[model samples]
Target chain A: MTTVFKRPESLKDTETHYCSGCGHGIVHRLIAEVVDELGIRERVVGIAPVGCAVLAYEYFNFDVSEAAHGRAPAVATGMKRARPDLIVFAYQGDGDLAAIGMAEIIHAANRGEHITVFFVNNAVYGMTGGQMAPTTMLGQKTETTPRGRNALGEGAPIRVAELLAQFDGVKFVERCTVSKPRNVLKARAAVKTALSLQIEGKGFGFVEILSPCPTYWGLQPRVAMRMIEERMEEIFPLGRIKEPAAEG
Target chain B: MAEKHLMCGNEALSEAAVAAGCRCYFGYPITPQNEVTAYMSRRMPEVGGQFVQSESELAAINMVFGAAVVGARAITTSSSPGISLMQEGISYIAANELPAVIVNVMRGGPGLGNIGPSQADYFQATRGGGHGDYRTIVLTPASVQEIVDHVILAFDLADRYRNPVLILIDGVLGQMVEPVEIAPPPAADLPAKDWALTGCKGRPPNKSRSLILGENELLEMNRRLQEKYRAIEAAEARHEAVDAADAEILLVAYGSPARTCRSVVRKYRERGYRIGLFRPVTAWPFPSAALAECAKGASAVLVVEMSAGQLVEDVRLTLGPAANVLLLGKPGGEVIQAGELEAEIDRIIGLHKMKRR
Candidate 1:
């Protein structure tokens, strides 16, 4: 019998520590599928950021380095510049990328470091008990935003995909979500394009995955998916925001 | 020996690092260590190594952390305020067990002090500047030639112990031009770093991190670090003494102040005063035992520093009250004049003789 579905060789067999119904797990699987498809699993070195995905190294079956909070891009820049032979990528969360590590990510992209960055924006700080994040939507109630995030008190959610797409160093930028099967397929494709850009010696590639956090959003698993579709997607639209020019 | 040439201390260090097989440099601009970043920006590209001018000192150190994870010979340089920004990354590098060289061309500080030289960072460098109970091997090089030698030594020791090595110089040593020999790269027999993260082509995947979520695991990690520090302290402490055995007055110093103490020792020796100079090359392992040995016949030990007696604390810790430790300190941005230091030396010896009579 021909097997149609199986775990990617790039993903380990161990169970993940991510919460059930979380979008991170789905996004992780998509990245693994792309890594296997591209046949670049052995030459890939992943950087895990300090957030919900801090333990991502355990699940990715390749060389991985755990970065300090918000410094993954800087780390990836160093690695890629030194090796250039290896495929390097950074897995980061909203707090890790948009908040404390803003300077690092901006500079890395501006410098045109040839690396892939998979940014998961769940809108709430999941591992840190749902504290307000940089991408946290205004009027959303979080641990720090107990009375609901006020636009005057807190800024509006940051559109990272659009912000990063403006840099000349960045060659590809996409925003996708995994709230449903149809969207998951698009996200999977986006992951492939981002990784492929690096393989093609293109500059920085950024994919913002508008993921779901059932535990922090105070909704059922299915309902959390709906919230991503209904609310998060409003601020973070899903589609390719920027793409490298087609080769002749 | 390579050809001798006139070189500034910061530029010589950059050339020495390139010769030492340094493969990557990530840095930000900060005086008086700006020459290092500028020199590396030019030299690294010429040698086919990578150089990145990071957005800030914090980013530079993390970039060093990244290069180190891949087993590259990575380095970063900055002055006092910039080094303060680097403390967090340094702590992470230490915990992650990465080999990196951090050069702090210290200027006067508690703030954006000045571009002038000072040794006030003694306590910060020696006492694990950032958080945690870890230690970094600190090397205080006094002159242009010594800075070149110590830059190479810093890299070797960093890789040897799998810990960060800090080269602490003040603005004086960082900028002054002097004639020095830039040597060729030695045939270094460094140990194999089997732990570096270079993709798992045919072997099991490698994961390197310092986050110990388990309390017991963190305890074990701390214990292992302590053991390694003990090993480093025993084997790596370096010091020098001139006529220490026959001295009644021992003047101890490091970095730029040591250069001044050398001249003071010569002037006192010409006057037939039993004086000697003790300079600690490696500040973290501290040369404590070696210093106690050098102070054996001395009646008084004076620590000459650019700070408020920071280095004197370590001397007192090594030799208690009987060593009669004195301080000839210049707080923050100024250097100690040779005339003042000489006068202090005379007072220390005169007081010792009066007490004996």
Candidate 2:
């Protein structure tokens, strides 16, 4: 009887190429909703990474530039610097942000570039056939780590939000998830807050969304969502990791 | 009014970049090219521009990629090893058809060889160093003045063609100081960048991408790129030929080697030897047609380089089998001395005479 749920105008009507129950679709919807609420869709520039979301440009109803793998932050830095009037953000996966692109993410965060970063940490390399990503949890099996991720050899899963929180240049850092409806609401809020900080010209803002990768995790969509709720959340704890100090 | 000052080649190029309306510069500090980075760090902010000392060459080039996508005149500088690190981003810039200027103040390499000047990257610069079928417009600037001039030209050509332009210099040209008259910024009218990703605003959203998974789609993209390259080769092939009309031997060189070969050619000509110099300014297009025309009157072509027969391969390709193209190279961080080049030329000439007899 009431029209409540509908697609955000900032999101395109095209069908997404994401796998069934993939967290990317949820995260994309959250970003689109935030962009729509802010009424900045016309001036927003999104940078798509080389991971599973490489085709993110097709789904967002705004100008998007696809960057080389792990170079999204640097690209976002360029976009912001070249046109500070526009809003810029980089959407990257764990492998694209924490591994090959580690240098780019760290330095961009350190430089305090006035841009937002939407980091989708699914704990495994989803696009490249479930390879062992830098955020691959210990004892979690992946294509590269068929016998499960060995802590002694492959090292521990990188806590990117915690790592970036230590940087002084960062104004805000939050870790949220889209495992359930409530968590999705929190992620949407975090995304909105991060974008708001960029609008206010505060500093670099980062939101790490612990997404589900059912195809790469070798589980059903519901099972992967449960895994994120019970297991992945323990490894990568949720909540705000950093925030700017209050003005005196 | 034009300003004249005694400046290092690196600094001169940085100043020229500012004059050419490059507002964003991203660079990492690498030897011999550090001056450009340092200069831009100070000058850019002073002129309401942005300068970022990126953590690595990889980040710097990607930053340039980002700025160029917004239709901003952007630049990055690095040395041999640093440039190697930037190959991934360069390839991306080429595939995306973004206009950015890159300066490679080359040093000896295979792996962190030395800080001395070297033209060993001629092949890397002219040929596609990064993976993919793409070409960057490579300009070899020999002197501080040419470095200044080409820095301005590199930006214009990059925007003109919507592709990356590389200024391939070496440590000597980067560090050497010379009194150069910085010209007024050119008044070349460039087309408005209506395709840049500045935001959809009043139109349908635009996507800037290089990845095409579909076979037909990828083929069409490559076809378009090849057409652009062919157009560039036809129009942008640039070289300087001196006394090539009736020369007995033509010396082919570029960058620093060209500067040294010029004096060698002069000394030989003063002694009544019909020797001439042919230097390629635009190295990527290779100036093949110009080289062939210059090689017509000459009995043989001698390619003197700092690398082990890299440019010589291009010379041979351009001149074909009928033309005698010989290589005289000094590898392993060794700059080709004028006297050594002279001796090689005389030895080759003597061998030619013996064969004729």
Candidate 3:
């Protein structure tokens, strides 16, 4: 008998506090697997943002620092600049990245800070009870948007990956999902690629993961996953929006 | 001993921070303190240190937070409005117990007031401007030399207590040029940063966090912080007294006003008047007990400030009617003139005489 399947060594054995069907747990496992595979668990410093994944410090066995809302990029910038030997990454939510933390994320990327960003776009504010987020779909009816998100009033959902891809500092920009097995594999690969780019001293690598917030979306876990496949994918197409330049 | 060099307050502070082992600086450009950012940008890279011109004061402080969490000596500088934006990050740094230095070259306040000198941020700096029941060790520097010395002290105190240290100065001190003898960094021994987020190599992962979601955990953390504050208060309350003994009248001030008050005291003493000056160095600890002790022999106490009576309240609380504690304020970028302070002291003495009669 061989031990084929088990928890990644980089992830803690304790159960996560994330809600069931939430994409954070799967994403956390994917990051942990990547960290373990790269053998950089001892050199990685993860920055947890002020969102549903705020308790990310508890799940990752590697060192983690908790940053204020929308300030993870700034924090990661500080960490990487201060200790260039360490691998720094920031885990941010849609509201954290596109809304409150807009200035921080943009400036960090524009400065070409050598760090990685894991942006989770779940459409709505899951931790704050289904409020209309910057990435919320136009027809999505959140608690704050009882009549659905009005594009004229609330504006269109921000395409973060595409917006960030335009920056010269950003070397790689990819949007992926974990709603299906194939998508999950793609997301895993995207995570690995982002980390590798950072490990190679490439300027700012960004991976936007379209996650599911079943608790806030007023749908079953499976239905929320299906929403990612059917609707969310239409707005946020899954693919690498930008890639690093080839070496000579 | 390093030869005396002519330098502004901001440049002196930046040079001193480098000497004090502050290997990282993250700051945004703000008026009256922009020189510090520029100085750090040029000097940090030369010293093999890192310097980043952050997007905003918000980003700068968070960057300091990140650097400090990894056991690096980090600092950020801003003026009044920029410091307001940094309060959120400052509170987080305080709660996480990270050692970092913050410099506030204060300008007039309430909104985009002016790029002039003002001590209006006294309350905001000393009274826990950000959320929570935490305190940052605040040191007010009066001159270019003091700014250099206090910055080195700020880093030491921040690391000694694992708390943020703030060096408060007004626009006058920040931009004024003077001959300052920069001392080498003090060889102060600091404890190991065992709690820093330096990765988990041979042991469990370390976490640098300020959030306490548990009800009981937060309360316990607050209690622990209170105890640490008490320890700091007991160990680090500093104030300067000039001819305080046998003085009939005492004038209390700090920072720029204290520098003016020193000259005022000298003039009064030359005229055979028993007038003295009390300057509190550590603004957060307030030096209440030391101030009250210095006020024991004085018949009247006059509080001079650049604000409309912020530090006077602390003085009144410390004295508690032991002496007549009067307030003389010049708010809205008005520099306190020595002649005006002298006239105010005369009026107070005349009133005391009337009461005696």
Candidate 4:
């Protein structure tokens, strides 16, 4: 019997520019798989932000547009409104989404633009050499926070999913990780829910994926995966923060 | 046979946009220019086009950005304060080289000035209104009919050069009713945009974007845009030289003030004064060449405007200081009446006759 695991057609065969053990590749593959399964490959437009996934358009076969740092939501808003028939998504890193683009994304969601957002939360700015992010966990060590993040000085990690869930225009909101197979499946489901909400014209949809950057974290791929499974999940927590309440 | 109907300048622009195949209008409510939004609200749905009243000017202009990327003939209209709020999105649209139409019904400014007409935004409109080195093709319409005619030309010029075109009208023109002959829509053989956000349907994918981050890359992008601007200036600089042929004195003005100057010219001509008018149609790549030509024989030039002589500086540059240029106008929401302008012209003419004789 042949194992049927394969790369999705929505992703090109080119190798990514990410460092070894960086979870960007996995997240990219997951998004590609979702795009493929939904059969919206040709009609999907992705916005690459100024973070680790800034060059994500290089890997995604569909049409892609690059956005200025922290302006992906505004750029995506423009794209979706101009081409309403296209499925639009923004792939952003933690720093890009939470730090600089906070106003843009919040305003976009508040306006209920019909677009899906795939936010990657790795707790650090990977491409810019591991700086602390808004989602950076307490006690996390980064170039900016060399002595580990302090709750008093640096503030606590932001729970974006929980925050976004409060907006009325948001149709779905969830947080998931890619460290384990089960978690990967849940992340895929979250992506599907977001896309489904967009297709139904319900409103804005967001899925934050807890990805790992082993090279930036100074760990091996397996070790990073283990850290995510053992510690990251405990802090980030999994499950849908907002979904339509089922009728009793 | 063309049909003439009485309409406000704002309504004329809306009709002209529809005739020009504009498919989307996104704007917020503001005074003096409310007619453009209201007209679009009624007209857009009739043609299966999209019309949205955005929560704010920021969102409305961003919506214009979105619509423009998808190859839609999109536009937004606002007064000075609202236009200031839209500067960010306009810069983005300019950087991307997306074709869009923006109408600024000039009102008093620097803050929430008033609903009254003022040319205070001359610097903002002629110069790059937003950050970055970009120029919009600015057209000043002095008449309600030209408001219709120029808006149609604005859309054409916007797409022809793949840049934003501003129909810079004043509150008086936007609100005042005048008879206008609405021309038939342009010929059917007009070109189509394949790169617009009409969806990639049955075609190779298209990408519309403006994030040029790389230093060398952005430089090259701007260089290319500069080249386009140079070409646009070469081909599209237009102006009106009414009665300038044998005049020793020339009057320079634009927009509604230009109409007032025209009336001044008519009254002074009847009084045996050899005065002429030079009206700039393209305010940005301004009608400098024509003004220079008209200034050759004139002993002096006067710029009449609703603001503090913004275009007078341009006249000085065009005339090279050989011609004595004077500015007669009011600022802060004051309209220069035709009688005031005529008195100034007569006094200048009388002074010139005394010196020559």
Measured against the true two-chain complex, the DockQ scores of the candidates, in the order shown, are 0.87, 0.88, 0.87, 0.36
**Which residue ranges in model 4 land beyond 4 Å of their true spot?**
A1-3, A15-21, A50-52, A67-82, A93-104, A123-158, A213-236, A244-248, B1-5, B181-184, B188-191, B197-204, B212-216, B354-357
Task: List ranges where model 1 is wrong by over 4 Å.
Answer: B354-357
**Distance from true location, Cα of A164 in model 1, Å:** 0.6
Candidate 4 global TM-score:
0.87
Q: What fraction of the real A-B contacts shows up in model 4?
A: 0.34
* Quality of candidate 1 docking, DockQ: 0.87
| Candidate 2: tens digits of C-alpha lDDT, residues A1-248 | 99788999889999999999999999999999999999999899999999999999989999999999999999999999999998999999988999989999999998889999999999998887999989989989999998999999899999999999988899899999999999999999999999999998989999999999999898999999999989999999999999765654
Tens digit of per-residue lDDT, candidate 1, span B1-357 = 678889999999999899889979999998899899899999999999999999999899999999999889999999999999999999999999999999999998879988888988989999999999899999999999999999899899999899999999999999999988877667778889888888888889888998898869999999999999999999999999987877788999998888888988887787788888999999999898989898998888888999987999999999987778889999878989999998887677677672321
Looking at model 2, residue A39 earns an lDDT score of 94
In model 1, state the lDDT of residue A80: 92
What lDDT tens digits, residue by residue, belong to model 4 across residues B1-357? 588899999998898888888878888899889998899999988987877777677767766776677677888999999999878777878887888999999898668887789988888888879999999999998899898888888888888787889889889999999999887565644457866644345775566566556769989999999999899888888899888986678988898888888887787677776788999998988888878888778887889888877888878888776669999867777788977887787788778772321
Q: Candidates' lDDT values, in order?
A: 0.91, 0.91, 0.91, 0.83
Worst 10 residues of 1 chain A by lDDT: A239-248
What is the TM-score of chain A, computed separately for every candidate? 0.98, 0.98, 0.98, 0.95
In candidate 2, what are the lDDT values of residues B261-357, reduced to their tens digit?
A: 9998888888778889999999999999888899898888999888888999999988888888888887766688988998898897787672321
**Prediction RMSDs, each to the true structure:** 1.4, 1.8, 1.6, 3.5
- TM match of model 3 to true structure: 0.98
Per residue, candidate 3 scores C-alpha lDDT tens digits across B1-357 of 899999999999999999898889999998989998899999999999999999999999999999999889999999999999999999999999999999999898779988888889988888889999999999988889989889999999999999999999999999999999887775899898998877788989998887788869999999999999999999998889998876778999998899889998888788778888999999989999888888898888989998889999899989896668989988887789888998998787686662321
For model 1, residues A1-248, the per-residue Cα lDDT tens digits are: 99998999899998999888998889889999999999998899999999999999999999999998999999999899888989999999999999999999999999889999999999989888999999999899999999999889698899988999999999999999998999999999999999999999988999999998999999999999999989998888889999776874
Worst 10 contiguous positions by lDDT, candidate 3 chain B: B348-357
Q: lDDT of model 2 at residue B53?
A: 91
